[model samples]
Target: MTKNGHRPKIVVIGGGTGLPVILKSLREKNADITAVVTVADDGGSSGIIRDYVNVVPPGDIRNVLAALSELPEIYLDIFQYRFDTSDRFFAGHAIGNLIIAALAEMKKGVFASVQELSEMMRVDGHVFPVADEPLVLNAEFSDGTFLAGEAEITAARKSIKRVWVTSNEKNEAEMPAAVPEVVEAILGADQIVLGPGSLFTSILPNLVIGNVGKALAETKAEVVYICNIMTQKGETEHFTDADHVRILNAHLGQCFVNTVLVNTAQVPEGYMDKEKYDENLVQVEHDFNGLREQHCRVISSNFLKLKNQGVFHDGNKVVEELMGLVGRPNHELRHREHS
Candidate 1:
């Protein structure tokens, strides 16, 4: 337990770049970690693999696996390796995608494939795809022209009115069984964290799953939403901190979440060069009165950091703040009052 007391079991739900970072940081602690990642990814390497092979996109899963790997630097290079130039067999493919696909084929189930991969990576904890099926995320605009697939939904220039999931493999409207261990982790967790990733695509995709949402709503664990450092141009465009919570609560409803973690440190001016950062940082704005009425406590901290050519939550800072909330009951202690 890293010279500390018992490690808290944590179940982090999300996908994309943020989930890996979250996992990487938490793995340093004494927590039993489980990452429930989204499988709706249909961009780049993951897309190519899913289209040709008809399996759940494994890009995010691959990333999470690598992040939790004991030999991350070595295995990550191998797993993340992409073909430098388009080729016949390796065109736009990640080595990890091929590895996961091959494993899924050999093992007969995505769940088993990931379990095998997790052991191979020597990850500190567990990782599961939110659903067992190849999910096609659908977003309906206010105009009623619905867009399907994560890639297509992201390409839409307009803001989405609502988002839901459907199966890419014919008429499969339901999500695959929630990995049993994931539900167990939630029910047994001391703290559960949501995003620092794309709200709809990365974060909500997991929530749209039936049992995933139910587990999230039913778990007595203290739920924490780590607000993104900046807004994505096509996704969160101009979302405020409060808007982030509003949308998540809207999708998962009030029963699922009890607390929020936000970056109180605004990006220093000019971090957003037109040629560089997206130039859209998330501003802090909370529905104080309403949130208080609903009993959802908002936790804020200066946890932003510059990394990997984009802004992110400082790994150490995130873990420190999250660890503070670990085992701490959902009390009405004010953010300032606690400090």
Candidate 2:
């Protein structure tokens, strides 16, 4: 709620590229948002910090902060800068990663640093790492073999059979305490968005969080899933929009989703040839017919457009479609003030 007194509260779950994009779009609608990001990132700067610091992985959390940022350009640029020199140890680190690491060291916690940074960024909505504890995601194959980390699971030649969080005998799985705020947002929300990212790694990791999952299941908010435009190489090689819903249901079980949003526009053949995207590998063809077969309502529109050198939803179009799902007006009043 703000001075003028009107805005929808929204809770979005996922991480990586999709979560940030969705957050950016929703923020444009002036919705008060809380992004519950996956903490299972074990690649690049995030994995390095998780291994050394033993705190919730900060990389994905940092990305979400940047996406939600509505600040000046210089500050945004500085936050995203990555050291690319031949200095092997720091070569792949991002400026935000180091800032977060230093803050964690000074404040004695990851969430504390995130809070400070969030304030500095003047983010329109709040962001939360799915769990405060460092959670290592483990993958298990049907043959009963276990892979220890996200990287290993990705690199494994065999397709991932299933994934789960790992913990010692004495502890139980739990979301970071901040997660209840996410639930509160959902319970009060007009809409809840799931993902446009990796099914297993980005979206499901957050969904499987203890209370977060239950809150989503029970919330009266209209649940909407922004299906991925392209299937991920190792994770969802041949998935369709319907396949996305099925996988979410498979992991979270039935009734996990109510509506699925898909791109109705067809990709140009010339563009596909120019980009050399593996059409056979994982393409999102308009398949609402297939999606409806899964017992979920399907809404399709021309959501795809070229942006940032890759295809993405014309953010405005995607948000408009989503708002329509819950009977909200597609107007600038989207960012209405609250009393």
Best by TM-score: 1
All candidates: CA RMSD (Å): 3.0, 5.5
Q: Tens-digit lDDT track for model 2 on 1-339?
A: 333456776778888766777778888777778787887888988888777876677788888999999889899888988888687888888888888888878888666678788998998788776655667677777567878777778677456677777541236454234345566776777778888777878887777665776777777777778888776666777667877787777776665677777887766654543355432244575556666666666777777876534566666787777655556432322222220
For model 1, the superposed segments whose C-alpha errors exceed 4 Å read 1-4, 86-89, 173-176, 273-294, 330-339
List the candidates' TM-scores in order. 0.90, 0.86
Give the total clashing residue pairs for model 1. Answer: 0
Best by lDDT: 1
Q: On residues 44-160, what C-alpha lDDT tens digit does candidate 1 reach at each position?
A: 888888888867899899889888888748667978888866586787788988999999888877888999888888887888887766887889876778888887777786677
Candidate 2 has a TM-score of: 0.86
- Quote the lDDT for 247 in model 2: 75
Worst 10 residues of 2 by lDDT: 330-339
